[model samples]
Target: MFHAVAKGTPYSWANRYCYTGMFCWWGSTTYRRANSPGAAVDTGWGLKFFE
Candidate 1:
């Protein structure tokens, strides 16, 4: 989870989570494993996955 990855509230970890969330939201679709059905939508725009 984001909380676990952001141990000690590290800046880099937080940034990575933010970026990954963005990528999953804009790159991966609702049907993809990365984006579940109940999860956020993906725009598939100028985003690069895992970025």
Candidate 2:
């Protein structure tokens, strides 16, 4: 499993790092310009599976 977070809605910068095995795992984060639109920042996380 993986997780992530962002700073702004109209994000300006973002990044993530992950690893995999029977299941996939990752970590991520994001940033946005001081002045932007939408919701101030955006963020998300996900998981992956391998056979």
Query: What lDDT tens digits, residue by residue, belong to model 1 across residues 1-51?
Result: 132234456566444543233334354423334545654544344433442
Q: In candidate 2, what are the lDDT values of residues 1-51, reduced to their tens digit?
A: 442333344433355424344665544645355576676766555454553
Per-candidate Cα RMSD to the true structure, in Å, reads 9.6, 10.0
List candidate 1 segments past 4 Å from native.
1-31, 39-43, 49-51
Model 2 ranges off by over 4 Å? 1-21, 26-43
Candidate with top lDDT is 2
TM per prediction: 0.14, 0.23
* lDDT of model 1, residue 19: 26
lDDT of 1: 0.41
How many times do residue backbones clash in model 1? 0
- Candidate with maximal TM-score: 2
* lDDT agreement of model 2 with the native: 0.48
Of candidate 2, the 10-residue stretch with the lowest lDDT total is: 3-12
